[model samples]
Each structure stands twice: as C-alpha cells, then as structure tokens.
Target: MSHAHPELRTPPALPEGGLRVIPLGGLGEIGRNMTVFEHAGKLLIVDCGVLFPEEHQPGVDVILPDFTSIRDRLDDVVAIVLTHGHEDHIGGVPYLLRERRDIPLVGSRLTLAFIDAKLKEHRIKPVAREVKEGDELSLGPFDCEFLAVNHSIPDALAVAIRTAAGLVLHTGDFKMDQFPLDKRITDLRGFARLGEEGVDLFLTDSTNAEVPGFTTSEGELTPAIDTVFRTAPKRVIVSSFASHVHRIQQVLDAAHLHGRKVAFVGRSMVRNMGIARDLGYLNVPKGLVVDMKVLEKLPADKIAVICTGSQGEPMAALSRMANRDHVIRIEEGDTVLLASSLIPGNENAIYRIINELTRWGANVVHKGNAKVHVSGHASAGELVYCYNIVKPRNVMPVHGEWRHLRSNGDLAVRTGVDPSRVILAEDGVVVDLVGGRAKITGKVPAGNVYVDGQTVGGATEGTLKDRRTLAEEGVITVVAIVDADTGQLAETPDFLARGFVSEEATFDAVVPLIEKALARAAEEGVGSAIQLEQLIARAVGSWANRTYRRSPMIIPVVIDA
Candidate 1:
C-alpha cells in the first residue's frame, strides 16, 4: 500500500483529465471531516464538519478543517455534497459558507433541513439542492449520484462521482443495519450496480473497521429500552446525540408503551426533535410528548426526558445535571440512560459523569452496562462484504484513526484488492487519480482551525499550549521595578502566583536571582524594559523548573521608575 510519509513534498499541478483528492480533515481522527476534489479546474467538496474540543483544547468551542489549501480557489468550487447531518459531517458547513456563501449544498431532505436550521443560527441563507437515493446531478465536469445508506440518523447517503479521470465512490458514515428502525438497510444492491459500472476509487468509512462482526441492529434495542422503562422506579432520562432521530424514536416508543410522557430537554434536543417531528422524520404519538413544564408537574414515574450530552461535554445538559447545575437534578431512584457510543478520548469525562450521577443515588445505565447503543459505522464483516461488492480499482479509508484506517485497508486486501492499490493517506496528504491509478502525489496545509467563542481561527496551538500550562502548572507573575539611572532593583521584585506555589514567601529565593539577573543585564547594556522583562522571565522560569520541577506560564513586568 502507498502510505503518506512526513517527507512528502507539495503536490504538483493536476495533469490533464486527472482528478486530485485532498483531505483537509477526518483522516487519522474521527471528526472534522472535509475533503476537496478537483477535476477540470473545478472543485467539489464533501462533508465540511467540525471536531469537538477535547480536555487539552481548553476554551475552544469547535475545531474546523483548515481551509488554507482551498481558500484561494473557493470560486472554483461547485457544491458541498453532504452525505449526512451528523455534527462530524455538517457542523463546519456554516463556517465554510461564511467564506463563500454562494456554494450550493446538496444532500437528502432531512440532511438539508438539519443544516438549514444550523445555518439560520449563523444568519446564512444557503443555496441548497435536496437530493435522495437514485438522484443524479451534474455539477461542472462531475456527474454525481446519491445512494441510500442506513445510519444512526435518517436520510444518510453515499455519493458516487464520475469525471473524465475516473469514478470515485464516497461512503459517508454508514452501516448495514439489516433491521433498521426505519426499515431502511444499506443499499448493497446499488453498490453492486455501481461496482458493475466500474468504480475507480472507493473512499469507505473506517470508524468501526476493527470490530469483528456485523453491528447490532437498531430494532433489537426496543426491548432493552422497554425493559428499562418498565423496571425503573422513577423518571428515566435518556441522553443521546440530538440528531439521532432513530434512537429518540425508540425512547419515545418505550415511554409511550410504559404510560409515560416524554419531554425533550436541552435546547438542541428540543429544536432538532421539533424539526424532525415537523418534517415527519420523527414519529410522535399525540399526547405522548409533553412540554418540559407540563412534564415537571407529572409524577416522577410518569415522566421521561430526552436530552443531549451523551459524550460528557462539560457544558451540555446532562453534564450540568450531573454537576447539579441544571434545573433537572439527578435525585434518588432516578434512572439515567446514556444512549450513545463513547467517542475516544472522552472515556474519562463520561466515566466521571457516570460516577457523579451514581453518587447522586441515580442508577446510571450506559453501553458498558446495557444494550443502549450501537455503532453507526460498518464493522469488519460488513466492510469485507462491501469490498467484495464494490471491488474498486483503488481503496482509500476515510473517517477514522490510524488503527481503524489500517484495519480497513487490511480488510480490503484480504478481500483480494492488491495491497499496492490501497492508499493510506492522512489529512493534507494529496492523492491523485491518473491513468486509472490513485497515488499519493504530495501534501497540503491541513491543521486545526479553532473556534473560540464567536471567533474563528483566532485561537492557535500556542494559545492552547499556554492554556494547558495555566490549567496544569498554573501561572506566576513577577513585577520588577528598576532604577532609571542605575538599572538596579527599585523594590524587591514582587511575586504573585496562581495554580503554582501560592505563598509569597515561596519566591523569596527567586527574588535575589531576579535582582542579580537584572543587574547583570544592566552591566551588559540591556537597557530596554523589554530586555529586562525577558531576563526576569527566564530567571523565574529557570528557578521554577529547578525548584519545583514545574514550568508554569511566567509573566514578567519591568517598570523603569
């Protein structure tokens, strides 16, 4: 297999009738999925999405796919073809549209509705074209067809793009759920037909490639959820992704069957479920769904709440409830169900929430303890089945970490695909299709673009590193007042520390060191306040590292008084 290496050079110009594929994100990671396809001097984007900030990326709201590679060529873009409405697939659309609002968005009906609502919040008026299974459209030099695919959310699709160079199929996050709640299974027959037509390259979802068997069907969860509703002594609170209409449908059914009224909590949960109900994607029985205020008046056993924060986000509703900061408290006898798969790196936060809710006398149920969730991506068996069905000339794994991508590539190889035809490229690695082969040509500028509270691309890696330093080792500020003529210490260098050794006396030894450094700098002709500040910062940093084995954020203020 051709793998992306660190020494890969910048890609050369596209050859005549050749197609270039550059993934900005969602390779080597599970979120912020964006890809750029160029053919005939026109660009077709697929899945502009966002990655949620982890514990290390403090104060960041969401991370975006760095658009540096395509920023200069936004005018050549035809449309952004979204295969689904999951946040990992569509959350970055508004940010991308902010750059070029005229770029048309193409997706299924429900997918478009979800994005439309999201765009409304950004005050963007999108030019949207809704397409479903079997719909074919031509944009510039690329002909695209949509195929139905069953996922956790409704109206998910897989797209096929045809150009003069070759045909590329992108299976956006999907699983072959034989018994989907909506009775819609993955379109394997459509995939077979596409294979017959000759797929030059296939970009498959690799999120669950390491799992051994077929994913559990969504239909099987009904009984498990019903059992929870029947056995719980008090109100049951189910947490999931707000866009998971199918899972919410199961919760609503279980609540109705157990003679309970369901109320959608959390702003996103209420808004999305309202949209799903209005659009008929979510079936709500009359009188079974009630307002939060109305449900609050009912007895605890007669009420059920559906909210977000299944991933343990600190600001989410479920997290606030666990912290006792939300209006709905986790009381004794309450049953809490976390109905989602745990994203990697969030295990600690999820377990913390689980422990907190358990401490509050609530019986917390999650994927570890019950059949509350199933993955939305195809496992190894299903991927092998698709490999046999499509049998593309070249295979590229998308939407997974390195291990998952490697496993998916191995699965394709085991299914008889030549190992050399497997392209293992991460974000920014450029792959080109020419002469009926896909090869890693070079690389591009792909990095994290942070969103920090109404600001895009404002917070950088340096800022996050400083935040982590402050969060971990804390900050220490040193103020040095120097003599104007002699450059000597005017006052004993004052020290104030937070998250470090807080006692002022703790810096008594460092004060003499700062004075000595300032005097030495003066004798060496370092007269400027900036130079003095730098000297003081180094002195304090050195002292802290030597004394406490800590390298905190050191802020030095030098005043020539």
Candidate 2:
C-alpha cells in the first residue's frame, strides 16, 4: 500500500528476518487498540478491540479495525493477548474468533472472565489462558511477561514481549496511580527492571498526553462520593462506565457507609458487577446489595443506585431515566451523580441529559461541579516519569488522537530520546525492528469496519451519505400503475413524501407536476415501464429542487398490469 504521508518512507516486505510491529488500530484514535508483532514467520496479536462510533457515523453501533492483513495468515498467529476487559480492548475478539477459534487468548483471570462472558453472547467458546503479573510464557519466537498496571478497570496489564529483534514494551492504557484502590500501582519497579534489561522499543498509552500534570488517583474520589451520599436529600443515583470497577467500588463503599442499600441498573452494570463480585474483584457487604425490584420498598434516603451511561448514550439507563422513559423514574429531591469523565465529542449529549435530570427535580453532580471522576490515562508529567524509568531506545505513542500522539512524541524527545528515535506512526503504518532500530517499513489495509445493528461492514460510505441525505432533505416516492400493452398510467400517480415536507399540502401541489411529466413521457412514445419511470423521476426531482431548493431521494415504483 502507498504511504498516506510521503515523508513516511515505505520499506520492503516484512524484512524476512526482522520483527515487524504493525498497529491495525488505536493509532491517531482513542479506541480499537490492536497491534501485530511478527517475528520470523510467527505473529503475536496484542489487544483486538473496537471503537465506538461518533455522531457522524449515523446508524453505526461500533467501529472495528480492518483485520484484512491477518485474516489470511491466521495459521501463523500464536495467540491474542488482551491488556484489559474494556470494550475497546476486547470487543473485537468475537469477530476474530469467528475467523479462527483455535487461537489461544492470554490475559489476567478477570480479563479472561470478561472476554469469556462476551464470547458466550456470540455462542463461541474460545481457548482462553489466564496469566498473572510476573508470569512468563513462551510462544513461537517471543517471550511474554505480564506486568500489573493501574487503569480504570481492575486487572489491567502492561505487556513486555521479548523477541529475537529486541524487547518491546507496550503499556496498555495506564496511569501511575500510586494509591490505586486495588493497591496495584502501575509496576514502576518492573518497568525499571525491564529498562535495566534494555527495552528496544516502548509503546505507551497517549490518551492524556495533552494534559500537563499527573492524573489524580482513584482514591481521591472516595471522599467526594462520601460527601454526596452524606448530604443527599433522597435516593442517590450514580452513573459511570460499566468497566470502571474502581469507581463502582467507591459508590458501593459510600452506600454501605451511609446505611443505604444499593441496586445495580443497566444491563452492563448488572452483568459486570455480578462478574466482579463472583470473581472477588468487588466487595459487597451482606444484604447491602439489593435487587432493583426492592427499591420501591426502601425509603428514598436509604437507597443508592449505580447505573451505566456516564457518556450520555441515548439508549443507556441514565439517558432513559433522564428522559423519564425508564422504569426507575427520577423523583423530586433525588441526586444523580455522573462519576465518569466526560469523553470528548460527548459533551453536548451528556449536558443535555444533565439538564433533563435537573429539570426533573433532581440535583445533578459531575466532574465539572465536583471531583467525582478522574482520568485513567497518564498525563504529560506521568509520561515523562515513565520515559525516565523505562529509558527505551525508541518510543511509539499509541491509544490517542493525532495531537495526543504528537504531544507524546514531544514528551519522549524531552526525556532525552533522540527525535529520530521517536516513531510517530498512524494506523496501518508498519514499524519494523531490526538490529535494535525501529523504522516505518510499510503500510497495510487498516481502516474502519462499521457495525450497524447485526451487520458488520454493511454501512458503506455511500450508505452513510444516503442516510444523511434522507435526514437533511427527506425522500419522495411515486407509485404508478400502468397497462401492460400501452405502458401508460392507468390512474393518477400516487405521491408520498416524508421528512421533506408536509404530505397534505406540499405533496398535493407536487403531484400535478409529476402527472404532467408522465403525460409528456407517454406523448414522447416512451414505450417501456423503465423509461417512463425514469422520465417521471427526473421531472419530479427537477421540480422539487426548483420549488423547495432541496433535492430529496425520488423513487419511481412502476407497476405494469
């Protein structure tokens, strides 16, 4: 494939002997983190994931990475390694497993459990292997070690894979939270040990590279959540990401301390919390966790509910509750706490839900108003700290947008890594490691595979364009019944319009113009139904554009009797 940017010189095929590091996704983007590490002829895939669609991708449920590069080489793949259980990190497993189910999956116990549950929904039973921190595994030509890392989710890990080329360290979405709720600080000591062994290339999370200071610890939110529970006048509802076990733990602790019974809302919240409690990741006091059905019997002051939709997803529990369409209505004097960071591009929707909740007589609290949420990714200062500790010969920033990756590259240079040693790569750009040197070799077929409903890659660019057209300009349908021999209209054409104009007034006026076009086509000796339909379409389209200054989708349904 040709280089998208000319400066990124393309090298020859896979260098027969060197290790090739190709990121299929999670470069110049926030989600769908996947990387391919190939040594000799064997491949090791790290973090097959998905990206949530933005507003522009209408009707899309999720965006998966294009795995065309590896689809044909499934036989050489050793295993699929997962850093954590976040949807963006593990959501693509089912898609990949459908191609080849024999490939083994390696991750922490909880991570495997999460992936197993996700796979069960797809009716796939994958080969899963659970590994803990400090456990090492040898697969093909690579030696893998898992190091515990602090992130929003429990059991997150940073991987160190040693190959013939060199040791490649990938820090998967980590923050150096010294006082993490689980007491599993991002293994700075282990990272230092790896640095002593000499890390050839370092791949770090750049999600918060634009932010200057170190991210606040998860422990900081405990006091704030306690305050909310202490002063709440009625039932307290907390919203956060379903994968945020630490945030949910804080909510649970506060509820237990305030003598309130907790109920889990949202499908994901209920399922994930149940998994966490079963796996001993979440601690719930006896009889403190009540079912949602028991909420009505409990007094308002004695109840606490934790739900999903901190990002203001339209169909999520929080949004439905805010819109007064949920089974659990927001009553007067209720407190709704948004205990998750406001992801970029979601401010408008999130604030709208907040406004609705406030209008419904509930007090809303979020990071803007109180310290209820903290980022799970490391900031610039923390990145600098990691660079000084890891001391890699080369650096590649991943898991962020273009600006974030560039900022992270700058941080790496500031840490004394030569500018040339920093690899600022985009998705699909292959970086090869040969003789301890990293360079952009070539590119691959890395793009987005949009998931709309149950269909993957069904919504193409043209489909999205048509959907936008219909949304903006509406559509028109002309149904004409004609005699088989004459190829002429048997009756006046039936006209229908939607989203374009009012059917009663505007459509009635346009019907005559369509009929006239049909008559003109018949007089011109247009004998075929296809020709007549085309004539009607062209005429109606021109008239509608001239009259309304808008061109809607015009459909001509010719029925020949």
Q: Candidates' TM-scores?
A: 0.99, 0.92
Clashing pairs in 1: none
lDDT for predicted candidate 1 compared with the true structure = 0.94
- Model 2 C-alpha lDDT per residue in residues 364-398, reported as the tens digit of each score: 99999999999999999999999999899989999
Model 2 — which ten-residue stretch has the worst lDDT? 1-10
Quantify all predictions' global Cα lDDT against the true fold: 0.94, 0.89
- Best candidate (score: TM-score): 1
Native RMSD of candidate 1 (Å): 0.9
lDDT of 1 by residue, 1-561 (tens): 889999999999999999999999999999999999999999999999999988999999999999999999999999999999999989999999999999999999989999999999999999999999999999999899999999999999999999999999999999999989888888999999999999999999999999999999988888788889999999999999999999999999899999999988888899899999999999999999888899999999998999999999998999999999999999999999999999998999999999999999999988999998888889999999999999999999999999999999999999999999999999999999999999999999999999999999999999999999999999999888899899999988888889996674798888888888978987898889998889999999999999999999999998888
Off by over 4 Å in 2: 1-11, 480-492, 503-539, 559-561
RMSD (Cα, Å) for all candidates, in order, is: 0.9, 2.9
Instruction: Give the number of the best model, judged by lDDT.
Output: 1
After superposing candidate 1, which stretches have Cα over 4 Å from the reference?
none
